[model samples]
Target: MKLKQLSVALFTAATLTAGSNSKADTITTPEVITKTTSAFFNCADYEVVGVCFWLYCTITGCTVKTSAKVAHYNPEITTQTYRNAEKPPWVETRVMLDAMQAGHDGSLIGIILETMGSGLDELGGGAGSENKAASHSNMTFTLTDSFGNPVLLASKVIGSSGYVCDPQLTPMYPYYVSNLDTVAWRFSIPEMFYPQSLNPFGSLLGSNSYNWGGYYPRIGHVTNHDLVKESGLIAFRSAHFLSRRGESHVYTTIAQNSREGFWPPGPLTEHSGKWQQLAPKGETSCKTFPLSAGTGPSDGLSGYRSDDGAHVWNLWRRYKCCKDRGDFLYDIEW
Candidate 1:
C-alpha cells in the first residue's frame, strides 16, 4: 500500500466495537466555505489521496459539478467524520448521497447513491484478515429521464471496476507517470494488468477504466482506516480508475491532521501541483461538537494519519449527532 513514513493513530475493531456508537464529528474545510466554485487542483502535500493518483483540487475541494444540489448537503461540505465504520456496523444509511441531473432531452435524471453499508467482511483476496470495506461506503447510482430510469448501483467499493475497458482489455489502457511527463504505459497484459488513471487507454486525462468483470464502479480497500465511526485495524492500499463520465471527489479523512486539506484520492484530470482560485460562496464556520467527556475539542473534528502515533483516533467520539446528514449536495465527494 504506498506507506508513507508517517505515524498514525490506531482505531481497531475491538476497541470501536467495545462501545460502538461514535459521535458524529465533522469539519467543513476552508473552515469557511462562503460560496461555490469549481476548479481543478492537486494537494499532494496534504496527503490527499485519489483512486489511483494521489491528489485532489485544493481550492474547490475536489468537486463533482452539477446543476442541482446532489444531496441534501452544501457544495462545500463533507461528512463522514470520526473515521471509522458506522456504529451498529450492519445498518445502511439510505440516501447517503442523492444527486440527479437531467438526461436524454432533459426528461430523466441521474441518481447517485453513496450509502453507508455495514456487514461482516471476510477480506480474503489482498489481505488475509476480515475487514469491513466489503460493505461500507458503497456507491450506488441511477440516471432517470422521461425515457427511462437506468440504475447503476454499486456492487462493490468505488473504482474496483470501471467501464473504460472492454472484455478483452483492448480499450482501458495505462496512463502517464506525471502531469508533465505525459508518457503512456507499455500496452501489454504483462505490463499493464491493473486499472489506473495513469494507465488510461491514452492518457491519464483520457478515458481510463477498470476490469468490469469485478463490478461496474468497483472500489479498492481504504488504507489504514474504514469510511467512518473509527472502525478499522490496519491500512489498505490499491490503485483504482474512474469509470463513467461524471464528477469525482475523494477524502482521506482518516489521515493525520495539522494539514491544510483532505487527502485527495487521485489527480485533477491531468493537472497536479498546480494552483487555481475558486469563487468563495459566503462566510460560514463549519461547527465541531464536543467528543466524549474529557476528550476535549482537540479530538472533536480532527484529521488523523494512519502512521501518526497519537491518541486522537481513540480520543474523539464517533459522529452520531450530525451523522452524514447533508454531504451529497454536490456531484460526488468521497
Candidate 2:
C-alpha cells in the first residue's frame, strides 16, 4: 500500500484497539491463535494479544491483535518565550511590540534563544583556540500586530565586536576573532509604523552602572562603547548565533541593558567629519535618499531619523526583572 494509506491504516488500527477493550470480557494465552493473517506481529504485542485471546476463550468473543506501529507527531504552538520550541500565539508578537514601543522607547527587542551547535576546534592550540572560539546563543526579533505573527525586517551582516584582553570583557566577548574588521552579524530593522512610541534610550539614561547586582555584568554596556555617549541608535548582537555559526551569517545579539536604543544615526551627524542635517522639523519618517557625493560607505545597519537631525538606535535590551515577570520582549510564529 502507499505510504499515506499505510499511515492512515496504522492510525485506524490503534484507534480500534482502544475501542475494543470494552468488548472483551476475559483473558487467554497466545498459543490458541493458530491463524496468522498479517506479518506485522511482534513480541511486544504478546501481552495485548494474550489479553484479547483470554477474553475470547472465556466469553466466546473475537480475538484480533489491534496494536500497530505509528509515526510520532507534534504540532507547533506558541510558548511563553522564543527559547521554547513551540510556536507562540498569533497575537503574542504584536502585544510584545506594542509593549516595547510604548514602554521601552523604541529599543530593539534582543532575544537570546537556543544555540545551533557547539564549536570546539580539535586542532587549534592556545592562540588558534582563542581565535576560533564560539559564542553562547542566537537571537531574533518579533514584529507583531498586537497579536503575534512573524514579520520580516530588513537587515544586513556586519563585523564582530573587536577583541579585548580585559577580564571584564570576557562575558560579552564570547567568540574569538583573528582580525578587527570582521563584520559582527546583526539584524538592522528600520523604524516602522507602530501605534505607540518605544523608549530606545531609557536603559542608558536610567542606569548608573552596567551591572544591576548580578553574577555577570550587563551585556549592553560591555558590547557597545557608544552607550556612554548616548548619541547613536542601539543595535544588538545575538550570542546564540555567534556561538553556533560564528560571524559569517545573518543573526542578532541580545543586549543586557534595558535603557539603550538600537537605531542608526540621523542627518545632523557628520557624513565625512562635518555635521549636516537631512530632514525638516517635526518629521519622523525614513526615506530612501541617495548618499551624498562625499558620504562614506554605508554601515548596513537600520534605524530612524527625525526632521531635526536626531537619530536613534534599534538594539534590543533586556531587563532581568522583566524576564522573571513573564513580560517577554517578543514572540515568533511558524
Candidate 3:
C-alpha cells in the first residue's frame, strides 16, 4: 500500500491527482521596497484592489514581494515528512540497475542509490494539522548525538548549490559503470537524526556538520557509521506517504510505519544477472535532464547530451544500442 508499491488502482488515481497539482516550490530572498504615499497610490500586494492599499502596506513597511529580491528555490515539501523518532531505526541504501533504461551494456548499472527508512506506526505528533507534530526531527534537531547536531532538510536532495552527496547522485546522475568499487557507497541512520516535514521530499536524513552538501565516498567505509565525521548526513529520499485525499506523490511520500527496511519500491533480491524486484527507478529520466553528462548519441534525443569524454553511453530512453533503420544487408537499389 506504500506509494511506490501501491496497487495499480491506487497508483493510477494518485498519479492523476498529483499531476494536476505538482508545481515547483520557489523560495526567494525578501525584496527591498521603499514605501510611498500619494493622492492616487497604494502598496502593491498579492491581491491588488487599487493603488490605495498598496501605498498603505508599503508605508507600513509591509509592501508586497519586490523585484529587487533574488529568486531562491526552496524545494519545500510543504507537508508530510514521515520520520521515525520513537526509536531511531537504521536504514538501508542500495544501488540497482534501472531495466527501464537498459541497453546492450547489460543494463548500465552503477551507484544510483536509494535509501529505505521507517516512519511512525500511525500519524503521531500533530501530523493531522499543518504538521504541528513534534516528530523525530523536531525533537532531536537540537540535541547532540553521535552524528553531532543535525539540520532540518525540507527536501531530500540538498538544494545548496555546488554541494554533492554521492557522485552517483549529483555532479552527474549515476549511470553505467563497470567493475568499480561500488562498496564506497553505503549509509544508515543514527539514533538522533533530523526529522523534516513540509520538505520537498518526505525524507529523514543525518547530514554532516558541514551542511553545505556532502562528502566523497571513501574506501573501507562502513554502511552505518557512529559519528557524523565518519558517516555524514544520509537521506531516505525514495520513501512515500499516503495523502489524506487518498492520493500521493509516487516517490516523495513514505508510509507511516513502525518498522524500517520497507523498501521504497518493495523488497528487492539480487539475482545472478540483475535485481529480481520490480521497482520504478526513482528519478529515472533519460540523459536529457539538465546538468546531465553522459555518453549518449549527439543526435539521439532532444535535451539529451552526449558523453563528457567519460566514455559513458547516454541512452535518452532508447534502450537499443542502435535503432534499426530497416536498411538491412540487402543490395543498394536506386
CA error at residue 104 for candidate 2, angstroms = 18
The prediction achieving the highest TM-score against the true structure is 1
Give the runs in model 3 whose Cα sits over 4 Å from its true position: 1-14, 17-66, 71-73, 76-97, 100-214, 218-232, 235-334
Q: Candidate 3 on 1-334: residue-level lDDT in tens?
A: 4322222233233324332221121110110000011100211111211111111133445432211111111111111111212211101101111122232233222222211222222211121123445632211110000110011121124422212111111111111111121222212122113234223233222222212122111111222212221111211111111111122111212112211111012211111001000011112221111122222344322222111100011111000011112222211111
Q: lDDT tens digits, residues 10-112, model 2? A: 3334333432222121111110011111111321121111110111222654443221111110000011111111222112122222332322112221211
Write down the TM-score for model 1: 0.20
RMSD in order of candidates: 22.3, 29.5, 26.1
lDDT of 1: 0.18
Instruction: Give the per-residue Cα lDDT of candidate 2 at 118.
Output: 18
Task: State the weakest 10-residue window (summed lDDT) of model 2.
Answer: 146-155
RMSD of 3: 26.1
